[model samples]
Target chain A: DVKVTQSSRYLVKRTGEKVFLECVQDMDHENMFWYRQDPGLGLRLIYFSYDVKMKEKGDIPEGYSVSREKKERFSLILESASTNQTSMYLCASSPVAGKRTNEKLFFGSGTQLSVL
Target chain B: DQQVKQNSPSLSVQEGRISILNCDYTNSMFDYFLWYKKYPAEGPTFLISISSIKDKNEDGRFTVFLNKSAKHLSLHIVPSQPGDSAVYFCAAKRADTGTASKLTFGTGTRLQVTL
Candidate 1:
């Protein structure tokens, strides 16, 4: 069983403040992803990392960035939090790409961030 | 453009009945499909999946049926229980494309089961 742990279950931040959402996976999967969930928008990818220090922008990456300094940890950074940035953030990991055609992602419990 | 779409936003079913959730995709490149169940405040869990090669895949009381020509899929849960009440999301990704193989997910269908 792959266990993906999120550092915070819920967080509240003020506008213009910087925020960090951390995630760590125990299975040592090579791919990590950050997504934001919104009503009518579903899960939109914000950023993803395939290797340490390597990151790629997903569909919606504005005002957000990610850091992957170690193999097991991935962090999502909100440069300047705003009321619109409030969302349920999810972290997911999967085995190395192309390892299997039918591979599925293991997701962390998620972090609900509220920007006031 | 939103490749995957879940037309119905919500569905209600009585216990011991069948709950059907539908999904559709516009991209023909999508070869693999998956269904995930998400409870409130929790991440979605992988329920079941079906490849383009197969039209139907079943696990326990959950079944997924895919129609390639129509580019649509549906998940059917028989004898639905209260525990099955949650948001169901349909996700799909193209075949074995190493790095850029990101999945496109539908908005989701919220299912409520009444006893």
Candidate 2:
């Protein structure tokens, strides 16, 4: 079984503060992703890393950034936390099963962030 | 644009009955579809998936049916149990890009089962 662990399950921060959400995977998957879930918006990708030191912006990358210094860890950084950033954040990983049509993502529990 | 949509927000069923959760996608390029179940405070877990080449995939008591022409898919759970209660999300990916597969997900449907 694959295990994905999040650094914090719940977090609270004040407006204008910087925040970090971390994720680690035991399977050494090559791809890692960060997503935010809202009521009507579902899961929107924030950022993703395909390899160490390589990152790409997803559809909703604004206000968010990512770090992949090592193969097993990925981190999401918020430059300035705000009420709008308060939501459930999820982390996921998948092996480079193939370029297309074959990757299965495994997800971590998720972090519920509250910005006041 | 919302590429994927799960119209029903919630559904309720009795034990031993069949529960069907529907999902629709607007993108024609989507070639792979997946279903995930999530409990409160937990991450969504991979349930089942189907490729464009196949229309139906079954696992245990869960069966997923895909209608490519209509851009719709449904997950049916037979003899639904209380343990099946959770939020189910429908997700799809284009798989056109190399290395990274970005998934588009639906809002999700919450399933509640009662005795």
Candidate 3:
């Protein structure tokens, strides 16, 4: 079984504050992703890292950034938290595609961020 | 544009009945499809998947049927139980896009099972 752990399940921050959401996966997958889920909009990708120090912007990358200093850990950073940034954030990891197994994401429990 | 769409926002079914959740995609390039189940306060879990080459894939009580011509797929759960209640999301991906490619997801459908 794969375990993806989020550092915090719930977090609260004031407007203009810096916030960080951390994720760690035990399986050492090469690809890591960050996504935000909103009602009626579903899950939108924020950022993803294919390898250490390599990152790419996803559909909703504004106001957010990510870090992948190590294979097992990926971190999402909010430069300046705002009320609108409050939402559930999810982290997922998967092996490089084209392997014998199909591409399937293993996700963390998710962190609910509240910006006041 | 929303490449993948789960038209039904919600569905209700009774225990021991069959629940069918539908999803459609506009991109013909999508060669692989997946279904995920998400519980409140938790991340979505991979349920089942079907490739474009196959029409149906079954696992336990869950079965996914795909129609390549229509670019649509449906997940059917038989003998639905209370534990089956959750938000179901349909996702699609292009296999040739490589490892860094992300899956396009639909808005999701909330399924409720009542006894």
Candidate 4:
């Protein structure tokens, strides 16, 4: 079985603070993604990394940045946390690139971040 | 614009009854569709999927039906149980030229099954 682990299951941060969410996958997948899920808004992509040091912006990348310094780890950075930034963050990885067609995603248990 | 939409926000059903969750997409270029189930505080898990070439797929008590002309798909769970209560999300992927494998997700529908 594939295992994707997130560092924190729950976090509380103050406004204007910097926050980091870490994720690691044991499956050696090539693609990693960060998404924020909200009620009535669905899961909107924040950022994705296809390879080490390569990143792309997803639909809603504002105020969010990602780092992929190694193949097994991906990190999501909140430049300056705000109350509106509170959300459930999810990390997922897939083995191949043709995810639009031929791959299945393995997801890590989400981190619920609260910004006060 | 929202490419995928789940109009129903919630559904309530009795145990042992059938529960149907619906999803619709406006993008005709999407060739693959997937269903995911999520519990509170947990990430979404892949449940079932179907390609545009086929119209239906079934596994155990769950079934997925697709209608290309209507650009709609639905998930059916028979003999629904209380444990089946959760949020269901539908996603679509268009395998066109440069879109990569990124999936577009829809707003979820919360389902609660009672005794």
Candidate 5:
């Protein structure tokens, strides 16, 4: 079974503080993604990495950045946290694109971040 | 521009009854659709999927029906159980595209099953 692990389950930060959410996958998948889930708004993509050192912006990427230094790890960075940034963060991984078998994503438990 | 939409924000059903959740998409280019179930504080999990080539797909008590002409799809859960209560999200993707092939998701619908 594939395992996607998140570094933190709950985090509290003050306004304007820097925050980092880490994710690691053991399946050696090539595609990793970051998403934020908010009430009524649902889950919106923040950023995604297709390969080491490669990154792409999603629907709502403002005030957020991502890092992919190695294949197993992907990190989401909040430039300066704000109260509005408080939400649940999810990380997912999938096999390399273009393969029909790689359609589904395996997700981590998620990180709940609170910005006060 | 929201490509995918789940108009209904919430639905309530009794256990052992049928629960129907609907989704619609405006993008005609999407050929693949998926449903995901999520519990509070947990990541969404893959529930079921349907390809444009087929109108219906079923797995156990869950079934998905797609209408290509209407650009609409629905997920039906028969004999619903209380444990099935959660938020359901509908997603669509263009199977032929590679660069921007990420799935576009709907806002989601919360379902409650009571005894």
Candidate 6:
């Protein structure tokens, strides 16, 4: 079974602070993603990394960035945490199964971020 | 624009009954569809998926039916149990987007099963 681990399950930060949410996948998947889930917005992609040191902006990438220094780890960074940024953040990974991209994505438990 | 939509925000069903959750997509480019179930504090887990080439896919008690012409799909769970209560999200993607592509997701439908 594939395992995706988030470094923190819950985090609290003051406004204007810097915040980091880390995720690690054991399966060495080629693709990693960061998403934020809001009450009515569902899951909106923030950023995704297809390979080490390669990143792309998703639908909702403002005020957020990502790092993929290694194949197994992906990190989401908030330049300046704001109250509106408080939400549940999820990390997901999918392997490039041969030439065909994997359809199934395995997700982490999610980190609930509270910005006060 | 919301490419994918889960019109029903919530649904309630009794144990041993059949629960049908519906989803629709506006984009014609979407060729693959998927369903995910999520609990309150946990991330959404992949449930099942159907490709444009196939109309139906079944796994255990869950069966997903797709209508390519209508751009819609439905997930049916028979003999629903209490553990089935969760938020079910309908997602879709265009297979042409390659490995870095992301799936477009609907707002999600919360399913509650009563004993």
TM-score (0 to 1) for chain A, all models? 0.96, 0.95, 0.97, 0.95, 0.97, 0.96
Decide which is better by TM-score, 2 or 4. Answer: 2
Prediction RMSDs, each to the true structure: 1.4, 1.4, 1.0, 1.8, 1.5, 1.2
Please write out the lDDT profile of model 3 over residues A1-116, one tens digit for every residue.
98999999999999999999999999979999999998999989999999999999998999998999999999999999999999999999998876644479988999999999
What lDDT would each prediction earn against the true structure?
0.91, 0.92, 0.93, 0.90, 0.91, 0.93
Task: Please write out the lDDT profile of model 5 over residues A44-103, one tens digit for every residue.
Answer: 889988889999998899999999999999999999999999999999988886677466
Write one digit per residue (lDDT tens) for candidate 2, span A32-67: 999999997889999999999999999899898888
Of the pair 4 and 5, which is ahead by DockQ? 4
Q: Across residues B1-115, which tens digit of lDDT does each residue of candidate 4 receive?
A: 8899999999999999999999999999998899999998778899999989999999999999999999999999998999999999999987762423578899999999999
Consecutive 10-residue window with the lowest summed lDDT within model 5 chain B: B94-103
Model 6 Cα lDDT, one tens digit per residue, B1-115? 8889998999999999999999999998898899999998888999999989999999999999999999999999998999999999999988677776489889999999999
Off by over 4 Å in 1: A100-102
Against the hidden true structure, what lDDT does model 6 obtain? Answer: 0.93
* Comparing 1 and 2 on lDDT, the stronger one: 2
Which structure is stronger by TM-score: 1 or 5? 1
Best by DockQ: 3
User: How does residue B100 of candidate 5 score in lDDT?
Assistant: 35
Number of backbone-clashing residue pairs for each candidate, in the order shown = 0, 0, 0, 1, 0, 0
Candidate 3 structure, TM-score to reference: 0.97
Total backbone clashes of candidate 1, pairs 3 or more residues apart or in separate chains = 0
- lDDT tens per residue, model 5, B1-115: 8889999999999999999999999999999999999988778899999989999999999999999999999999998999999999998987664643477789999999999
Rank by lDDT, highest first.
3, 6, 2, 1, 5, 4
* lDDT computed for candidate 3: 0.93
Candidate 6: residue pairs that collide: none
**What does DockQ give for each predicted structure?**
0.59, 0.71, 0.74, 0.61, 0.58, 0.69
DockQ, Cα level, model 2:
0.71
Docking class of 4: medium
Put down candidate 3 lDDT per residue, B3-114, tens digits, no spaces.
Answer: 9999999999999999999999999989889999999988999999998999999999999999999988999999899999999999988766677758888999999999
